[model samples]
Target: MRSIIRILGVARDLWPTYAAIVVASLAVAGTGLLTPFIVKAATDHVVDLTQGNASGIATVVWLAAALLAADLANTVLTNVSGYLGDTMAARLRATLSSRYYAKLLALPQRYYDHELTGTVINRLSRSITSVTGFVNMFANSFFQMILTVVAVLAITAYYSWPLAVLLAVIYPVFLWLTTITSARWQVLEAEKNQDLDVAGGRFAEVIGQIRVVKSFVQERRELEVFDDRYRRTVRTTRTQSRYWHTMDATRRGALNVIFFGIFAIIFVQTARGVFTIGVMVLLIQLVTMARQPVFMMSMVVDSGQRAIAGSRDWFAVMAELGERDELPAPVPPTGRATSAPVEVAFDHVSFGYGDDDAVLRDVSFTIRPGERVALVGESGGGKSTLVSLLLRLYSPDQGQIRIDGTDVASLPLEELRGGIGVVFQEAALFSGTIRENIAYGAPDATPEAVVEAARSAGAHEFVSRIPAGYDAEIGERGLKLSGGQKQRIAVARAMLKGAPVLVLDEATSALDSRSERLVQAGLDRLMAGRTTLIIAHRLSTISSVDRIITLRDGRVDEIGTPDELAASGGIYAELLALQASATTRDLKRLRQFDIRV
Candidate 1:
């Protein structure tokens, strides 16, 4: 009940439409009740015709006309009420969808990592449909049922108060039964929804990783997993359906008995001459009309229960705390001054994921403006975690990170992020044209600037060679392009952003020799005059960096110039020696296959 009220509160702006629907519903009910009275009057006029009264024919014609008019009013009002109900439902859906989308954007990255995409999508879809169903049922069925009962009871009382009193007593009993049964069914329905969510999650996971499944030849295994989940969903749905069917049957039987009782009471009254034949017919029709609302109660209850369940899920997501950025609103940039290199400092920063062991502990470092530094460490040495902290993707557990002598947390999120550009090992591209992807960070970038950035990144030649040049559509995640092409496009995008700080995470680690050379040249151009941090496995890429920071066990083990580190006989020197040995082995293998031309 609280969930229903809260859901309605979301559509408060559409109260006028709801009001109109209520008025129309009452009008529709009023006309329907008048219909039986007109019928009763017409029947009386027919009976009077046996006395040879000519005026009875005219009276019957007038009564017939009134009945037709009442039917016409009922039809028109019913349609109007339906239209209004639909309008309110549409408004409610729009409000909820917008709110849900905003909530998703505001949620932290950690939330997404643990939540299944299919489960979230399914809940959102179901919530929208269920809320709409609830609104429609409330207006057309619930409200109409109330108005219909009241109108029927008032007219029946005019004929026979005792019969009206009896119906009033029976109505509450049916309502109570429906309410209790619906509450129990809701629990089962919720269980069924949970099963469906699990099935949907598995289906989405399998489809998204279809290539991996095929490569591993695990099609049969995946099919079996999906079948198991689907069977569970089916079993739960069947159980809920059976319960609903039994309840519906019981409700109908009870209503049928009450209907017979009302008919019998009218029959006895007429036999005793306590009522005329017209009154008897009228009472019977009214009694029959009253049964319709009671029958409709079951459907209303079912829809209401489903809606409540869906709204609970919807509100649960909305209630979660969103990502908090303490930064203030951004101040407009002053010309050319905003493009200066950014000096970054980490002041004894410490971080951990949950209560697990710290990923970074009391780490302190600084890079002067325009200095190029390389972070070298084995996997799980907290290299990426440091970068993520700098990007404010996750905050440090202790200490402050400052940029250009100002705490990063003091700057607006848009301002801080807008000042830095990144190129990851895997170039993440959306489904769009090459131009759109390049200008994503700077949507309003001029065509000339985009082309210039591409030219600098060494992408213009290849881009021009394509049929549509920069306008060409790149398939999902730019899968249509080769590794080198995707990386160059990513570089071009970063260049177009023209941020003061650049972070390259193993940018050329996966490319062939020819592709790596081309990508390296683009990286050189991109890193020019910018404060750059490079994370790479290949010593060749970082040999000329201003300094090297080697990490061990979440702490900085050594920091020095490449040559300085090599002469010190430390971790950096050992890594260089290992690479040299690998290179010597490769040359020896080449000599084994040599042939003079």
Candidate 2:
């Protein structure tokens, strides 16, 4: 009930339309009530004519006209109510969908890690549809059913009070049964919903990683997994369907028996002359009228229960805390001036991903403006975590990080992030033209500036050689491009943004020597004059960095120039020696191959 009220509250903006629907509904019901009376009068006139009453013919014509008028009024009002109901449903759907989408964008990244994409999509789609269905059913069916039931009972009482009393007593029992059945049905619906979510999540997981499945020749394995989940969903759906059909059959059976008994009673009373033929006919029609609401009551209750279940799931997501931007509003940008280099300082910062031990423990470091520093460490030694902190992807558990002498937390989120450009090892590109991808970070950048950035990133030569130049379409994630080409495009995008701070995470680690040379040239140009932080695994790439920060076991093991660290015989020295030895072995193999040739 609370969920239903909340959904209605979301549709509060459309209250005027709802009001119009209500007025139309009432008008239709009023016209409908007069229908049986007109039919009753017309029947009595026919009886009078058979009994040789000469004026009965004119009376019958007038009664037929009245009945036709009432029917016409009912039809018109019902159509008007349906139009208003449809309009209200459309408004509610649009409003709720937009709100949910905004909430999705605002939610913190951590929320997405635990939730499946397919499950979220299903919940969002189902919930909105449920809300709309509930509103339409309530406005068009349930409201009319109530009014029709009440009007029918009143007219029945006007003819015979005992019959009306009997119906009133039976109505409550039917309602009680519907309420209990619907409650059980709602529980089953929740179970079915869970099964569907699991099935959808599994299917989506398989489809997203289809390449891995095909390479491993595990198509059969994936098919079996999906089949298992699908079978479970089918079982749950079948059980729910059986329960629904059983309840429907039970309700109809009960109504049929009660209606038959009432009809028999009316027949006996008429034969005893306790009622006229017209009254008997009217009572029989009213009994049929009463059945409409009783039958529709079950359907209304079923739809209500489904809507309530969906609303609960939908509101739960809406209730989640969104990512808060703690800083004040952004200052307007001053014309096209270049961003100055950023100075960064980490002061006693510590953080953990909801663990007892910190990933970065009391780490302290600083990079002067325009200095290019490389962060080198063994895997899980906090290098990536440090960069993530700089990006404010996660907040520090203990101390603060400062940028340009100001605490980063105090800066507007957009302003803080807008000042940094990142190029990951895998160049993440959306499906779009090359020009669009390059200008993603700076959407309003002029085309000349985009071409200039591409040239500086060493991407212009190849981009111009393509059929459409910068306008060529790149498939999903830029899969159509080679490793080196994708990295160059990514570099071009970052360059176009022209942020003061650049963070490169093993940008060329995956490429071949030739590709690496091409991408390294682009990286060199991108890193020039920027306060750059490079997270490098290959020691050879960072030999020219101004300084190296070596981390070990979540603490700074060493921080010095690469040459200084090499002479100190520290962790950086050990890594350098290992790579050197690997290189020597590779050179020897090359010589042997040359001699053989």
Clashes of each: 0, 0
What does candidate 1's lDDT look like per residue over 479-573, in tens digits? 78987788888888888887889898867765678767776787787777889988766778668799998887888888889999999887778
Give per-model TM-scores: 0.91, 0.90
Worst 10 residues of 2 by lDDT: 588-597
Clashing residue pairs in candidate 1 are none
Best by TM-score: 1
RMSD to the hidden true structure, all candidates = 4.5, 4.4
Query: Over 4 Å off in model 2, which ranges?
Result: 54-69, 325-337, 510-519, 583-597
The 0-to-1 C-alpha lDDT of every candidate, in the order given, reads 0.81, 0.80
Question: Which pairs clash in model 2?
Answer: none
**Candidate 2 lDDT, 111-227, residue by residue in tens:** 886789888877888888988888877877766777888888888898888888877777788888778777777887888778777767777777777788999999999788878
